[model samples]
Target: KEVKKEIRNKVDAKDVNVLLDTKADVDEVNRALVDLNGQLNLKASMMDITATLQEQALLNTTLVAELCLGRWIWKSLRTKQGGLVPWNLQTANSDPSNLVWERDRTHIVCATPGLYELSIGFFSRRRPLVKVLVNSEPVLTVNTPPQGVTHHAGGRVSQSGRYTNSSVTGLTHHDFLALPAKAKVSLLYEGDDD
Candidate 1:
């Protein structure tokens, strides 16, 4: 009985009501804080996912091309010479994207700017020096050694085959070049003796 009397004296009805109100306010504020934290976490996760997806989309934008000078022969040439050689540019066979062959099919025009890996090959009677040119400037060269035999069976005959060896030599070159948008690429041939 005495303890109950002391407790009632220390905490009156009004004091108990005020304490309860303060506790309710604290509980409500805690709940709101928790809700706000959850929302912030969700937003951060969504932003991370969006950034990852954007990076993947950028990576998917790829451009590739393959070209060859198929069976095109240039005869009766002397001295160190280099020029843009025509390529057998069948769009179906070449499978080019973000790039286009010019009207003459001697050069490739880039539609997008990025790093491109170019692989070029040439086959001719003599092992001609192959060069990859960007905007009419030679950036890479490959001097392939003669592959096949040079045959002279009969006397010097006035013919293309007689002057230029008939044996075909293959030359291939690969280069990773950084090109800007609308850049032009071409294959230049040199070292052909008639």
Candidate 2:
């Protein structure tokens, strides 16, 4: 009876309640720790993505511009003076970070000085000579040959047949040219017919 009384004194109702409350507190603390770890991992992933974007922005420093002729351009008359081709459409302009294009004029102005790839394409029903010019100086020229042939029969023994050419011709030129800041570039066309 004495031993039993000592055990009862040591583990009373209040002590048992206190032990249960302590276990509950430990479980709540564990859940909070788990949530905090998940949030830290998400923050780390976000930081990595931001760093990658910054690196890509630094590596991609090129500026590009593209101009195109309007529809029904083939119906226009051609000139032999090699005049500047009027581009009525702008397919792409610079990224605004490094270049600017004049929408009203036939010039593409560079904001950053670097080597740029210039490409020009000309399509015409007659054989045409296309020139890519930088600051009024011709850098590249493309001459498209006539496409079709027409045969004419002749009675003369020396001249049996005569061939005439007719068809649409296309010419393209690609050049890697270096330009300083504020340089102007344009395309010139010379042909007999549109």
Candidate 3:
């Protein structure tokens, strides 16, 4: 009861009202939780709840449930080796964030220049090699069954579309790479040019 009063005092009335609602959106509740972060001493359980519900909300969509999330890769949407991967973005952060999917629906335009990480997870029978291209030129590429990679000086890779096998990512030891502001980035599979 004392803790509840403390929270009510620290947070604004609108946020407090949003908090008391039993049917508030999970994302909205998460926002309230974020507002409380560091404002007062709270139980570890509160932090645990915040972590567990991070960026997720309840869904009642039937088609998504039918697809089972990961099994719906559209083979037809997979473009040729040299072309931009025809991506079908499903969900994104509801809150305004630093990165955004470009209007073209083919690139993720980075708004700020900084080290960034992008993960591409997919299952394909053919080649698993993929490339991360910045503005039409490749940044990171490696050999098949890649041995190792040394990031070229000035942090640029050849534009010829050479890419490494996906497994090589684990061996690289780095989590993020230098990305330029307004960099239009996309992935491409090292598929047959024929």
lDDT of each: 0.61, 0.58, 0.53
Can you tell me which runs of candidate 3 are displaced by over 4 Å? 1-76, 94-97, 102-104, 142-175, 192-194
How are the candidates ranked when ordered by TM-score, highest leading?
A: 2, 1, 3
- Candidate 3 structure quality by residue, lDDT tens digits, 42-80: 556776788666634333333333222111122354574
- How many Å off is the CA of 178 in candidate 3? 1.2
Write the residue-wise lDDT of candidate 2 on 1-194 in tens digits: 99988997787899889888777577788999999998987675767889998887766632123321122132234332447765454555436444455444555656656677765556445446777777878877777433463322221233334513333335555668788777776667776453
After superposition, the stretches of candidate 2 with alpha carbons farther than 4 Å from their true spots are 1-23, 27-53, 60-82, 94-99, 144-168
Worst 10 residues of 3 by lDDT: 65-74
Clashing pairs in 3: 142-164
Predictions: Cα RMSD each: 14.4, 11.2, 23.1
lDDT of 1 by residue, 1-194 (tens): 99988987796788878888777577788999999998987665777889999888766543223332212223223222346676553433233455665344556777667777776665544567777778888887788543563433332334566445443335665668899897888777774443
Best by TM-score: 2
- Which consecutive 10 residues in model 2 have the weakest lDDT in total? 63-72
Q: Say which prediction, candidate 2 or candidate 3, comes out ahead on lDDT.
A: 2
So what's the TM-score on candidate 2?
Answer: 0.55
User: How far out, in Å, is residue 82 in model 1?
Assistant: 5.6
